[model samples]
Structures are given as structure tokens and as C-alpha cells.
Target chain A: MRKRDLSQFFKDKRVILLIILILASVISISTIGIQEGLDLKGGSLLQLQLEKPVDQDTMNVVTTVLDKRLNIYGVKDVKVRASGDQIVIVEMAGVTPEEIERLIGSPGKFEARIGNESAEPALTGSDITNVDMYEITGTSWTVPFKVSPSGAQHFAEAAEGKGGEKVYMYLDGKLIDENPPTLSPELANGKGATELTVTGGANTVEEAEAQAMAVYTVLKTGTLPVKLTVIGSNTISAELGEQFLNGAIIAGLLAILVISLIIFIRYRRPILVIPIIITSVSEVLIVMGIASIIHWNIDLSAIAGLIAAVGTGVDDQIIITDEVLGKNTDNTKRRKTRTRMSVKNALFIIFASAGTLIAAMLPLAYVGFARGSSGIGTISGFAFTTIIGVLVGIFITRPAFAKFLEIFIK
Target chain B: MLEKFMESYKLLIIIPMIVVILSVGLIAFNGLNEGIELKGGSIATIKLNEPIPSPVLENQLKTALNVDEVDILNNNGNDVTLEIGTEVNPASFASALSGKGQVISYNSIGPVLSDEALGQVYWAMLFAFIFMSITVFIIFREIVPSIAIILAAASDIIIAIGGMSLFNIPLSIASVGAILMLIGYSVDTDILLTTRVLRRREGKVVDRAKEAMKTGLTMSITAIASMVVLYAVTVIFIPQASTLSNIAAVLIFGLLADILTTWFMNLGMIRWYMEWRT
Candidate 1:
């Protein structure tokens, strides 16, 4: 603790990286202002624009379908109403863009009619088993989908005796394909076809792929109604959100104080403890920076993820400290070599632990990605933040911590 | 050095095993409640204009909404969390609570996306286990030490879930996140112990274990301290967020469970394995 060699510390790449990141994070935070999620912000709002202006009746149908779809996802307290003939406004609290966008983004309604524009779709989306990935050729696209046997039966009955009549594909009452191929002569008498492709031609390959993707998405989501594209989405937090955030902040600060006290007690030296705390704090700040840069809302689950990441960061710090000082405090001629060996060993444990932590976190992140990371920024947000925090710890902060110990612990 | 008692310490592995068995039983019999996040429902908080007991409020809500099922998730003096059933109409809800209380907030959560999400939860758990096992195996490159570490981690999670079931902490997204955090902490201490006890030969096995314990316990207590503060803060300051409360509570349990799993269960096995190997 005697010497203050500032230049060497600055020269260390680990310290340099840590300092740069912490500075960047501070800038990112002040500029972007850490994105508070629904739990902190209260609730969110989403605006959906219908493909075309429809009747009040059609709008009602659209709103009702959207409401019921959210209900299916077990979300209640959602107000799905039409802003106008063309706009449907959905207001809710504690949900994410990913959750709602995945739920209501695509109008799940898919219908096939043999004779043409009719309320009675011979086959509904439920009839389809799965929507295969789109296949693109030049400026044409086809989304192949297979139907259940019963769906095939229903299709046969609809297409019966309609020889040479073109069958139309409709998604949310809009024509998926205009000038569709006429019924095959073999199928003209009502031969059953389980597999069907919604073929579309566009001026450009991108357009064709986009058209095919729209079909694929709608088919995959079970069903959606009245093609509504998300135009705007945001949420406001409840007063409870503010209260919860304050509580979390207070609790977090108190926790940090407790952790610092423990670290101070363990090392019994401000020189060692200060850097440990600073390293962890910087790690968290950098994580918050990355999160803000990516605009990951800081929700309850996300907070949990942050804690999980930082928790391991502290654990690794303890491991490094113990290993570096363990059984080799004597001033042997081999002190530097032993310290290097200890740092290397500590790095091994840090990397191994980081690997498993990330591995454990990946599933929750994957689930959050798949679905259920709804309201108040649930599952996946936690994993996302946790993964980011761990990566920051291992790559940036952990090495800096070791470098700090290497410099002064002798 | 406590070496005399250390011989019998190898038997301590069964303590966590028995705890795990009992935890499994508790979970099986009680069954973990999947929070409304997965099960279709909504949470509404009403700020009381007048002082009302939680049960009284629940009764009023049941009659007002004409729904027989209403749960009082939390009662934080003025802010009472009303765990009302799904499909709530604000108009009716307002009318239902007109004079009784003011509507602070209402969130009606329906069921999660689908069965696929539920399936994904299981898959996620499986993958976490598989990956953790692989990582431990790679680290130790020894089957027994690696498997023991993974088993301890698994047991910590199972016991934590059992603690949840026992304590009525519902399995929600928030609590699941807590469990995930616990998984990391559990593996952390185990890894610390295993690495120090098995890989490092500078000190006697028991001396190395005691040293690892000192470091591991410090890590655990620091974590536990935070969770305690968090839980206390959530309960006292922001009781309306029952979901937030779940995260803190579950994390506390998982961390506490990790201590036992790591120090006793995993440590005993490692010591025994070391002795048996010798």
C-alpha cells in the first residue's frame, strides 16, 4: 500500500478497458437515461394500425379478437378499443414490446375460400398443422403448410364441384394472393390435399420473401385477426412502479453497504476492499450501459438478472483474492511466479463458473425469447441482463480486479 | 484443526440428502402454485379511502365483482393487492369499488402464451442441468467430483422450489428468475470448494476446505444480506408488488439452501471422495 504508481495501472489493458467502459456507461446512462420498464414506468401503450379503414363493426371484431387473444395469454386488465376506423389502441401496464408484439402483431386469421370472398372460410388457421419456412425463387415465394386430416376433409368439401374455379387465400379478410392458380383438374372434383402452399409473386425478391414471411408468421401463431401492424408501442408504469423502484433502489443500496461491510471485514484493508467494490460497481454500470444502449428495459426480472450477474462477479472477486493471498504471503524469491500461478488458477475458476452461470441463464433467456416474458418484463429480460453482466464481469472487471491485486497485493 | 471431528464430517452429506428428500415430499404434496403469469388471472391494487381489513376488502371485491374467487395477495396498509380473477372490466370494477376504494392499478393477466411455454420451462431446466453438468465435467475432468457438484446444484434448486411451495411463494416469472440466480450461487460455492479441495495441493485437504469455506461463506452471506434487505424493503416499503416480493423471498431461500448444499453436502462428498481415492 506504500507506492502509488499511477502510470502502470493506467497502462494495464484490463484497467484501461474497465475505465473506458465505466466512462462509456456513465455517458450512456446520463444521455440515454436507463430505460425503465413497465414495472418502473407503470404501464405501456401500443397502437395498431389496421391494413385499411374498415367499418365500425369490423373494428369491433378486430378489437374483440385482440382482447380475447391477450386473455388467452392470461393477461387481463387490457383495454382493446378502436381509436378510429383504422386504428386500434391497446393500453396495458407491465408488459413488454416483445410480449405484445409477439402476441397481437400478426392478425392470426387465415382463411381459404374456393368460390371467393365469403365469411365461411372452408379452412381456418386451426386446420393447419405447421407453417414451414418460406422458400424463395427469383421474385416468387411459397409458404407451404400442412393441414390436419379433418382440415383436408373440410377443404375437399369446399372445393367440391368447383372445377377450374380459383381458390383464394385470405389473411384477416385481405387477399393473400390475387389471381391465384385455378383448381387442378385432378382436384377439380374435390380431391383432398393436406399440403398446400400460399404462393405469391412480388416485383422484388425482398417483397416476395416479406409476403411469404407474413403468411408464415400468421400461420405459426395459431390465429390472429384483422391485420393490425404495430405503429407505436410504449407503456406507463403504475404509481406502484415508482414505489417498487424506490424500494429496490433503497434495498439495493443497503445490500451494497452490507456487502461492502462484509468485504471490508474479510480483507480488513480499505486498499483491497475499495477496488473490489469499485470493480463490481463498474461491472454493474457497464451492464446498465449496454442495457441502455440496447434499450433493454429495467424490469423486475431484469433486475434479478442484473443481481445474478453481479452476484457471481463478487464471488469471483472473493475467489481471486483468496487464491492470490492463499498460503503464499511470505516474501519468497518466487512470490511473483506464485502470484501469477494463483491469478491463473483464479481465472480458471472464474471462467468455469462464468460458463455454468451463463449456461444456467440461457434457458430462461430462451424461454423469455420464446414466450412468457410478458408483463413487467418477465423471464427473458432477466436472462438477457444476467448474461450481459456475466460477460462484462469475466472479460472486463474480473481481469481488472486481478490486475489491481497483482499491482498492490504484493 | 478439528481433524478428529472431520472424520465424522464425511457423513454429513446425508443431511442435505435427507433435506432434499423432505423438500421433494413437501413439494409433491403441497404442489407449487404457478403464479397468475402462467395461470390466467389479473392483479389489481386498490388504495383504500377508508381503513379496511384485507379479508373485508376481499369480501367486498367478491360481491362487487360477483366473482367467488378473490385473493388478497398483500395488504400494505393503504395499498392492498387484490388478486382478482381474470377478465375484469374497468367499468364494472370502478362501479364495484366506487365508494370503497380508489383504483390504484389493475392488471388482468391471462394464461401464458400456450402449452409450448410450459414445455419450454421444462426444457430450460433440462438444458441448464445439462450445460452445468458439462461445464463441471470439463472443469474437474473427473466424473465423481463433477457429478457431485451438479447434483448439489440440482438439489439446491429443488430444495429452493420446495421452500417456495412450503412458504406459498408462487412459481411466477419473478420467482423463476430467483431460482435461476440461486442456481448460479449454488454452483459458485461448489466450484470454489471443489477447486480448492481437489485441484490445489498446497495445503492439507481439511485446511484447504476450511479456507474455501471462509471465502465461500463470505460470498454467500454477502448475497444473503442483500436478499434480506431486498425482502424486507419489498415487504415494508413496496408491499403492492407481490411479484417483486417473490423474487427476494425465493432468492433468500435458494441462497440459504445453497449454503447447506455447498458446505455440507458437496463438501462432505468431496472430502469422502478424496479420502476414498487415497
Candidate 2:
């Protein structure tokens, strides 16, 4: 049978592939879509150093709890993981440092006592207005806390019960009880008392004051059941991250330009240029889209992965170009055979190479590889996007190359 | 010169026999340099304010931690990497070392993490094989070339990994990436050779294969050069980047071996099969 219009070669299958791709591109753009990386959309990165002596088991539990808390706090695209023992890295998209500090740093260690009115009186350390480490002329250091007017009234009323029996001072409901008097009349006005003293079993007056200060902050917040301590706090300012991001963008553009120029010089035609350029651009876009969709925080490691992908993708495009131009056997309408062979080879190599990378990355992103959800998502996002780029190359860019080759490649 | 060169059977049989022997030996002894990620261990990075003698710090740490299996890798004399494998209380060790010098960083993964990482590596290799075979079969419509290419790619990776193990180089996440990278490189060269032969060019099939090799070799060499430079930079300049540097080293060796196995051994076997079938 005679070959049916070899010149109009890319008619049936090629057209169908193009329609599918165009539809996909349109759908992706229009929909409630993926979340772009922190690099594209700004976010907060908080690095906390746990107090020494914390093990991986404790860190893991803390990480899980923090993740749950952040989710509860309405921080979307949150990543909570341990970098190692002692440092937990938290990445929260659209969260401020102050919010993170507030959530993670709750100093709610207090001694509270139950009264008739309520189970416990909420008294903050700050409520104990004055803590003094005073020394009498010949005595050792003595520390005392002076209550506010409201606290004084409550103290007086409690002391009146049971003949000047000690009204216990509590922090977070812990009892710090001391007897003030043996008579109700004596306790009522402190008339028989030498001096009213609120003290802890601490070594010196300084220790007492420090302990009081620590308790004061937690009581002031009045938050309960959530015990959090800020061991370490750091913030990467939005402005600096933005400047770094702009520099990265410029670097990426320059890399693409240099690479395209090199490919053009080596291949010496616009035929190869079209596919290489398209695939390269599509790789970046698809990676960004995947990062957005997967909510991967595109950090510096991700940027490195992208640059590496561009290099690999360019090499693949060159192979396709070389296959088309340098090796065509069919004499009668050889261009058709060449185009067919090139696309077939391009598709094969792209699929094979991308298959391996995807296989490797899928596991990295899965439950098995890195226990934490940080590195895997970012690094794997780059791989996943590049693989998508290859698919896009198969459908859009390679066919685009075919059309260009038909026009430009003699 | 041509007649004399053609008599060299060393290129045909001996080299492959050597490769097989070397690959087997390495694979058998691969247990020695089992990756830190695979074997549960402690990897510590200590950054000093200034360069210090390795022995002084090494001895201090070794005596303090009571660790004998410690490697004091002075990275550019500025950073020291100590990998401790024996189980010791990490906090106690860090505290003990902190007295001598500041402990900049340390990471410890339980046996669970290592087991998980190994499992993932296994699945990744399996998925790669299945995916490559299916895709190649669709594109080529010929199972023989596809199978040969896949086998060649696998052989290249195994040999690369074996070589790394034999050389006492730690198999890392980067090396895993390197193995995957070689799969692409190996298949590319095999496909290039196959296409040249299938085109039925004006010259003899063998002659065209040689011509394809010229181009394929150039590409491989360039790639090897780049990877070599990358390896050097990773190893020499970036001490912390163990994974990336190790991967570059594997790729350099794998791509170099691939030029021979993929382009020649596998390509030769495929052509022989095709001729035999016809």
C-alpha cells in the first residue's frame, strides 16, 4: 500500500496529544490550584533549639504535637520536623514569627490554690507585685513577695479562717503554703505578725526572685493545659528572603539563557532550539506548580535540584535533535521517517530517564525514607516536576520540535 | 596497523571477563562500607572557631566518649566530621565533647530510620526497572532491545555500586541518585547504538556501530568530565555535602563503564540477537 501523504505526517496521534495537553494546561490554570512554594509565595521558617538532653523519641513526639497545634492554629502548608536532636525546624506558610513564638513559647508554670468561689484562683507571677531579696543586718539573705491590693484582700480573708493559719500561695495550682498566725484576730490585720513573708525553698534571695519572674510570665497569659518553652528562637526576615528569591530568579534566567545559547551553537538551528527551550521552561513551571500543589517549601536545596534538572533536560533535548537530523534512512520522504524516529527516540529516553528519577523520588516522598516531611517533599518536588516536564515534552515540546524541524531543518 | 589491531582479542573477551570478575568480587564484599544511612549510627559535625590539630581533638573526643570506632575527618582543617557507630547516650556524648569544644551539630537515627531507608531504596530500584521496561517496550515495539538496554542499565548501576563499596566509599542518598543517573546514561548510549544499526546506513552494521560510538563516546566523556569536577568540588570544597559528592563519584565511574557495557557489550548482544533471529 502507498504511504498516505507522508508530508502531512503528524496528523492523527500527534493532533490528539496536542489537544489533551492544551486542555490540561488550561484546566490547571483555571482551577482552585496547587500552593506555590515559599520561594514563590512568602512564608515563615522558625528554627528552635530544644534544651540539651532531649532525645529523638522526645523530639518526635514534640514534632507531632507541634504539627497538630500549628494545624489547629490555621497555619496552612505547615512542616514540622526535627533537623537533629536539639533543633526542630518548622516551616509555616503565611505565619508570622510572633504567632509562632506565642504558640510554642507558653511559660505557664504556676502554683494555684482552690477556693470556695472557683476550683482554683488564677494568680500570675506578675500579680505578686514585689519580690525582694533583702538581708537583715546580721541574718542571711531572705526573699519575700508583696501581694497586690486585690491579692492582699484575698490573703487576709483566707488567713482569718482557722486562727491565722497560712493562706497557701500557689502557682499553676501548686501549693506554697505557710502559717502566718495562730489567731484569726491576729491574722485579720497582721497586728501580731512580725512581717508577712511569701518565700520559696530556694537557696538565696536571687534564686527566689528568678523563680518568681519565671512564674509571672505564664500567669499573665492565663493559658492552660499547654506547656511550651521557647528554647531557641530565630527568624529569616521576609525582606532578606525576598532579596534572595529575586537573585535566584535572575540566576535561573541567566542559566537558561547560557544553556540555550550553547545548544543553539552546538546544534546550529532553530529546530532543536524550540523543543529545548519549551521543555526547559515547562520544567520550571511544572516544578513550581507541583511544589504549590504538594505544598513543598521550595528552599535552597530545591533551587539546586531545579538547576540540575535544567542541565539534564537540555541534554535529553539535544539527543532528540541529534536523532532527527543526523540519522535518517528512508529516501522517499526521509523527513517523515526522521521525524518519526526522533520523536520515538526522544520519548523513549525521556520516559526511561524520568522513570528512574520518579521511582527514586516517590520513595523519598513516601513514609519510608526520611522520617521528617521536609527534605523529601522539597527535593522530590523538583524530581516530580522534571518528570512532568518530560511528559509535557513528550506531548507538547517534542511535537513542537517536529513542526519546527519540518520548516527549519533541511 | 589495522590488521595487527584486529588481532587484539583482549578488547573482545578479556575486558568483559575482567569486568565480571571485578563486579562479582565487589558485590560480594559490599558489606564492609555499608552506608551510614543503612547501618544505624551517629554522624556528628563539629565546626571549630579555628583550625586545630585532628589528633588532639580526636583523642579528646575518643577518650571522653569512650569510642574507638571514630573517624576524625578534618574537613579543610576547619570542620571535623566524627561518625560514631557504637551505641552511646547521644546527649552524654555531646555534653562530654562540648567541654572540649563546641558541638556544632550531631544527628542520630534509630534502627527504624535505617530500615525504612533501605526498604525505600529497594522499592525505588524495582519501580525503576518496571517503569523503564514498559516505557521502552512501547517506544521500540521490540522487546529484545528494550530488555538488553534495561539489563545493561542495571549492570552499569550494580557495577557502580559494587565499585563504590569495594573502594570503601559510603553508599549515601546521593549515591542512590547517582545510580539512577547512570541508568539514563547507560540506556542513552545503548539506544544511540541501536538506532544507528537499525537505520541500515550505507556502511556495514559494525562500521556504523563504530561511528555511533564516536559520537556517544564524546557525549559520555563530556558528562564524565562534568561529574568529575562536581565530585572534586563536593569532596574538596564542600565537606558537608557528602551525599552529593559521593553521587558524583558514582556517576563518573558508572558513566565511564556504561560507555563500554551499554554501547558495546549490550549493543553487540542485541545486534547478534537480531542477526540470529533474521
Residue A115 displacement (Å), model 1: 29
What is the CAPRI rating of model 1's predicted complex? acceptable
Assess every candidate by TM-score. 0.74, 0.64
A-chain TM-score of every model: 0.56, 0.57
Residue B253, model 1: Cα distance from true site in angstroms = 1.4
RMSD of each: 13.3, 9.6
Q: Could you give me the TM-score of model 2 versus the true structure? A: 0.64
Which consecutive 10 residues in model 2 chain A have the weakest lDDT in total? A134-143
* Model 1 quality (TM-score): 0.74
Error of 1 at B257 (Å): 1.6
On TM-score, the candidate that comes out on top is 1
The stretch of ten residues in a row with the least summed lDDT in candidate 1 chain B is: B108-117
Q: What is the interface RMSD of each candidate, in Å?
A: 4.3, 6.5
For all candidates in order, the CA lDDT equals 0.76, 0.56
- Give model 1's DockQ, 2 decimals: 0.28
In DockQ terms, which candidate is top? 1
